[model samples]
Target chain A: MKHRTFFWFFLPTGLAMFLFIALPIVSVVTQSVFAPHEAVLKTVENCTPLVGCTTETTIDQEATREIREAQPLGRFVGLDIYLDRGHLAIAELGEAWDTAETWGDFWDRLFNLPLYRALAFTLTFTFIVTPMLIVVGLMIALAVNSLHRHLKGLMIFFSLLPMIVTPLIGSLILFWMVDSRGIIGSALVGLAGDPNFSLKASTGLTWVMLIVYGIWHSAPFAFVVFYAGLQTLPKDQIEAAQIDGATRWQQIKYVVVPHLMPLVTFVALIQLMDNFRVFEPVVGFNASAHATSLSWIIFNDLGGETRQLSAASATSVLTIIGVAILLSPVLVRTWRDFKGK
Target chain B: MASKAQRRPLGLSILIYGFVGLWFILAAFPFFWTLWGSFKVELDFFSIANWTNAITGERTKATYDSAFTGAAYHGAWVQEEFWRNVINTFMVCFFVVLTSLTIGTLGGYALSRSGYRYTFWLLITALIFRAMPPITLVAGYLLPFFEWNVWGILPTTIIVLVAINQPFTLWMLHSFFQNIPKELDESAKVDGCTQFQAFRHVIVPVMWPGVITTGLFSFLLAYNDFAVTAMLLSESNRTMVPAIAAFLGTTYTEGNVMFAVAAVVSATAPLFILVMFFQRQIVSGLTAGAVKG
Candidate 1:
């Protein structure tokens, strides 16, 4: 009777995921195969428009002055800023700059430019941060856990502050700190007695700062999860290891780490999924000649002409594939490992 | 006690702690910078700047005054893009929450508690949504949805946002429902409570934390989003993040203080309120699968 009554459970949630999530993902594959440059061009040529062409976002002259003046290079162009658009030649921003022309060539560059670079950066970032978080979180958890059983209920609540701080805001806060002229940077400059000092002047240094910022905003979750996972572990396993004269390192490596593999895998997977979604920081950073990520690159494509969306969508579809191909192994391993348990 | 304390390199611990502590300060500074910037005027930002030759420091309070006024010199936020975004945000939040909760709770209870029909298909459905990149999905069909709308871009954006959010809320709710034991519900029904009554009295009480977490997450997703909103929304319906982003290299020339201030205030409000208040409930269960614990 219970099972019979509950039969309708899947429809609402199932249908929603189908119509929205699954359908869009499938759309990516279909669109990629079908949305060749020529096809997209033809579609744009035929379609009327998403919005009326008469509409324009005309900025007030005074405000526009401040905006134009803010640019390090006088003024950066608007949506039509894509160098290869129509007949404009992109003055290569640097020799390091990768170039793409036409929608197809651009598609190649999409993969070549930031896709893998961002992917690698994201992966490395995750690899380093997740472990750090777990360690820090575990230590905090142990300290909190050992004090008293009554502390468990309260400490558990206290440990969740970072979850409430959206990653977007977290990233932004980091951005301002290491910002070229931000207070910390200013202090560093003052110490050096060099007014023009900027942390971003050193390329490697800049990346380190970015990674450091990522970990700061993210570590709390790792700590809390390890803390909770710590609670679930039996006291006897560690006690037995200690009694047997196992070093603390041996106990953690065998007893603790083995117990934590599932949780560690879960944390790594979630962070990996989110790491690619790195738009907030890259966007918020608001410094440097260029700061592009896989997500930001795709986002930039959409803001161009309405016709560019198909091309943008194509890149997005490819990105989705890229992620699937990359994460498939890790995901499968996680599933298999969990199933083995 | 002294030997124990002196066993390891004391200096290394200090170095590690210092690095971590400094990182936390850096991680959390932009928010405070925004808070400080929000209280000041545009002129003040220019004069008392972070740098003399640096671009970020050059942006003034005037940029902000113009953003709210949209008049460059004087107007109202109500007449500006900011007010409309707030309206759009509120409407989107209200509808998304109400609809998604109803669907997720009902669906979750049935999926978790009962061996119901088509459960396989439903689980697949949830997984599929969980899998896709949101920005891409929304961008692909912006035209299709836009054509179907009448109120310029507002209606189209609202619909798409709601659609993007439904899956996760449902998934989270399902997990919430599953965590409770079947005995709790059976016992309640045995005591003369109906199915709905058991859910309302017994299950709902136990699972309120999950519901709140799901709601808060969805709301944040809706609120903090920039890429999807930028892709789907037209200028008039532009949300605050994109608007500030646009302002970065546009309206105020390169005056970032406008963006600096607005980004800080608009983005931090909900997060600050939620984290500082229901900090535990926010993290407790919703992210359980994602985190180790």
Candidate 2:
């Protein structure tokens, strides 16, 4: 293709991405370093015949409005928002470090910061869910592969349901089922022999519910990928392993798993990128009280009557940085492949 | 494999069947349960007095004089005017998918055909864009959209979704186009067809299978999105997912949780139908990326 034709062919998508994806990234970084204009203040003095002069301070609303209108991007604060208590909390971290008596105490204080708390859960959720889903998905793929052809299609159709449904809707379905009066919740009450045992009341239980929901929502994706990988498996290699007198487990361990290794990596990388943005489930499960994620923090900031754009932008920047770090390995590998080609 | 299965131990086969059966229940049972529950009243759905009431709809019978009723659905679809949101969702999905596929096919074809290092970089840039959570972009868009007075509307949301859908679409169609044997287009070029004419005549007809697959995914992304729609749309123009989210806020306080339940079920019905019809395309599209990698 000629450069001019290529340019015309790619122009629409390239322009859309540049305006929406690329430009917003720049906008977010710019907004992060800026803060909304503080209210303009004025002092007024009133002298009365019988009383002494009185001085009052009031917000100059007109001036504030003019300033804000003139510069809608807000005033540049240069990383002040990033270091504030709502974000990195550098000062608070320093204080907690010095004032803590024990390592456990220090850790508790560390988790108290909003950003750190969200970061902790996001990382924990990403790390735990990705690996567990891979194992569960692989197990399902193997089990389904061994099934009769008639049953295989039915199993796959059912399997895709959890993954195909909207994330918030899926979590909501699970959430309602685990309500105190709902079946699963009542069953748990009976098992524990405690009427007041509520899944939502404790942080640990909420985290567990969210993680379980994560696996349920994403495992099918892994299963489908691995199932496809299974279809293209080398028959001779499997037969050779069988002829060597290898057991079923050994054949799978040596022949099957190694063959699916690339698919596993592919699934893991995609899941990592996804699981890091764990926002919808938190909202659906109403687990924000017990657990939060980086994406959720940004959403919370950007929501409600007070649109805290600067605060949200800072979190957005941090989240983007996190994604870039998580994506670096894949990026390096892709670069190597491109170079080799 | 057939012989191997026959030679397998009985206990092992039984275990595999048992596990798959358990999994089948786990995967499918929740939607069934929810669909059944959505017809009942709040008390029956949440069953405070007896868990069996959820199954039998005891309170629902007491209230509506029937074991099952369309009262919740009526309340959701009529009283709340959820049909407006439903219409809004479809409109957004329709435009997002159309625009995304239109532009993505051209760009993807260009990338596949171009023998340049820049094509590699463009895809990598797209991969990075794909990785960024949509909420982050929402932060950037909020200020500008509000300033421009285009923040809360369907068209704006649709364009944003199309843009967000581009990276994945390009990658998918790029791979698909790569497999089409460049010789087809080259042969057309040899017969006095310009590049555009060749694309229009030769490539377009044969591209539907891949295009359909990519379109199915594009539709899914636009349909399943919550972040962009929830933030970008106004109250009157809200889509089904965000509308349901809003329902939770008002209905919970009003003791009308059944409304939200019905709305959720209604919203999910279309996706169920989509999967039923396009299961094969969805499966192939999913594997398309991973298999190539």
Best by TM-score: 2
**Per-candidate interface DockQ score:** 0.29, 0.84
> Judged by DockQ, which candidate is best?
2
For model 1, give the RMSD to the true fold. Answer: 11.0
Q: Residue A49 of candidate 2: its Cα lDDT? A: 88
Query: Which stretches of model 2 miss by more than 4 angstroms?
Result: B1-6
Task: Please give, for every candidate in the order listed, the TM-score of chain B alone compared with the true chain B.
Answer: 0.75, 0.98
In angstroms, give how far residue A339 of model 1 lies from its true place: 8.5
- The alpha-carbon lDDT assigned to residue A222 of candidate 1 equals 70
Docking tier of model 1: it is acceptable
